[model samples]
Target: MIPPATAPLFLEQAGWPHAAIVPLAGDASFRRYFRVIEGGRRAVLMDAPPPTEDPRPFIAIAEHLCQQGFAAPAILARDLNEGLVLIEDFGDLRLKEYLEDQPGEELAVYARAIDLLADLHQRPVADVPPYDRAVYLREAGLLTEWYAPATGLVVDAPAYVAAWEAVLPLVEQGSAPVVTVLRDYHAENIMLIDRPEAKGFNAHGLGLLDFQDALAGHPAYDLVSLLQDARRDVPAETEAAMLAHYKAVATPGADFDAAYAILGAQRNAKIIGIFTRLWKRDGKARYLSYMPRMWGLLERDLAHPALAPVADWFAANIPADKRHDALVAFAPE
Candidate 1:
């Protein structure tokens, strides 16, 4: 990471008269963000590590999405040489924080978020690459390599792999129209910006972020991202209602319930592995604490008769007793 003073200096050298660089919270990526408020206007400053974290692809994708009439931050300045970019600032309140304070209107806010997702999924991006089988398998492998070791369990490798592999058929069968999905369109990535002119669901405009991994894939995948959140508890009834709301606007042939079940299964499977890997490789146990909640999500989805076979398979193999032990082993102290 570059020093704060050097970041502004680099911006100055790049011909921006001056910049006010204040760091923004980032997750487990090499990317860092700063809100640059200068001339009474706000812009986000991205400091991406070029050697390990390339920004070009993300930048290009954001621009293409903007052209397609989506809410992507406009690029104000770029220093490709330094892997730094200046973009329009969306504001401070993330959807997660916003929802925490707006308990009375939580479902309503999620309704709008889902509306944005519907628009996102409706856009065609034929040229964008799809997340094929190799990627799916690779992600699953992370759990085996990282989480299993962290939990001190000689994870049944074949069982773990098969656990996720078991769902692939369902994944393919449940595919929706392929579109550019903001792969991580969760509450944490959204910003609540003030826009009075925007009406109806647009009462408070949404700011999108961490969309660099956007890919052409299943439409309902992101819906699952928001609805079946690993971090928070979303009610089953609320989940059903949100599914219905999305279905009301989705295209013909898109089976909202089936897609939701498959996506819920798919995402939870990936997260199980992610939480495991986070503990083992990064020595971060905080994520491990969320596994039970995630397991609960998988349990909920498996209740769908369509997913019963996979559910039964997991229960028969993983066993609730072993799962309880696994959770107790690595969860944060």
Candidate 2:
């Protein structure tokens, strides 16, 4: 629901009336989206309230993507002070929904997504923070901070940090040349843009969303986000094929496999902690249901030889049987 204090200002800025606005589903962030219809014209009103989040990064990133010839939404109007921006509506067809409706087209859809990433990797990082080891270590630390408490386990913080420190350098050494990494490049954040004449595998057929948290980092990070998605299950064969396709096109070095696995494990580990925090701190329990899937992904990534130290940490701290939903595992009877 739009805040009563900001509703009038948002409507006035978008030229939308009370009757023409319909709420849209929001993601994990504090941003709220609404579909505004005025005179049969449709646009999306993004209300990202102040203090918690600012719309400046999103606005800048969207413009950057558009300039790069990608299918990012155009900003129709904006009020940074009010934390509102009216943007082009990409319609209701997110890539995840499209795949759900047309399961047969999964491979093709993912192929296009991978191709988009290939194109993105060719561009140098723009105005964004670097995804360095400090960032990686801090993010991965969430697992120990949140998940441990949620599961009634006490992890040795110094040992956990040491384990990650050992693995992160290998990840950096093995990754492809640095590029703008869309921190959350999963299926849910992708859209299938309608562009029939879009040429080549690296064209603008795919739409990008939820890139406000984008960073300058290894290319393998986003690939991991896509193939080893948290909210959805991607087949092992499909993931393998997509990885091969990316390798052929992008020509990343042989070290790409090790980097992908290390980054995948890092990402999944952060997600486990984030999900647990969502349930305990934000009171969002639905994220708990995805924990088992996330654990499976983490386990797979940990199997890589590069992740031996972090893998050992997980094995010692979180037993396989105990790595289920922390809420359920530690719930009061």
Candidate 3:
């Protein structure tokens, strides 16, 4: 939390005369945010902890996307030295909440979301940093670190390492045209707003949020992140239709279902590690409730014939029945 004395300094700097600051909800990071409203116009204020959270990427990406004609939160002002920023608030109706009342129209809503994603993926990949192998391995490695300790099972780290190593050649060979992949482009990060001012069905489609972490990554990665969302149960048929929609827009090329499965397996493995870490390291056990759903997604992804080696390694090393128990221990009761 910023001291009351310091709040005046930021308000003065941003030129929002006599700004009244109110705390906004935050996620699992050290960063803090507040909603600042004055004279009926609203904006969000970010209080990022320097040395832990960097504001440069958010600034750079916001500017780049704004130039490229995407709907990103507009940057109103910034004090980089103090890690403070004022941004246009995209409003508060998350897609997760929107889908709840209108469950029957979920697929239609997702189709529109996919259209936006296709537009993002069509952009040149070179404009952003590569979502390289080192980061991939490091994310996957957390599985052994967190899951093993939480479960009290000594994971065969070497076998796990080898499994991921074997996956690399396949990933490289299966690489599709790169794009500015929204690293966490699932339902939670999307906001649904009324399109009172626009003239189309998708006018109120979505408001992108928490996209500061966006980076260049495989096109298939975000698709899996959306279709195979661990928190919500997306039907197999709906998943197939969305995949078809994406493939239709993509340049003529080999169908990348195999690569998609591989990436999903990789992603799910990393998420299990994250859920475990959240429970054990941060003591935020509420996330543990989602572990079974995550594992279920991982198993479904691994079921694809293309990921045989990765699936086989998991089957041979990790006992099926015990997995859920280990995951729940770290979850809040």
- Candidate 3's C-alpha lDDT? 0.76
Q: Candidate 1 residues 90-208, lDDT tens each?
A: 77788788778887778888888877777766776735678666666676566556545554556566665565566655555544577776778788887776575321113336767
Each model's C-alpha lDDT? Answer: 0.70, 0.83, 0.76
Worst 10 residues of 1 by lDDT: 196-205
Higher-lDDT candidate among 1 and 3?
3
TM-score of 2: 0.93
User: Across residues 16-91, which tens digit of lDDT does each residue of candidate 2 receive?
Assistant: 7653777886778789888877786787888888988899999889888888878888888888887888887877
Report clash pairs, candidate 1: 147-276, 147-277
Q: State TM-scores per candidate.
A: 0.86, 0.93, 0.91
Q: Give candidate 2 misplaced runs (Cα > 4 Å).
A: 14-19, 195-202, 329-333
| Higher-ranked by lDDT: 1 or 2 | 2
Candidate 2 clashing pairs?
A: none
- How large is the C-alpha RMSD of every model relative to the true structure? 3.2, 2.8, 2.6
What are the per-model numbers of colliding residue pairs?
2, 0, 0
Tens-digit lDDT track of model 3 for 162-275: 777877555565446767877787888777755664212134367676767776777888888899886777888989999999888774135488778888888888988987
Give the distance in Å from residue 26's predicted Cα in candidate 3 to where it truly belongs: 0.9
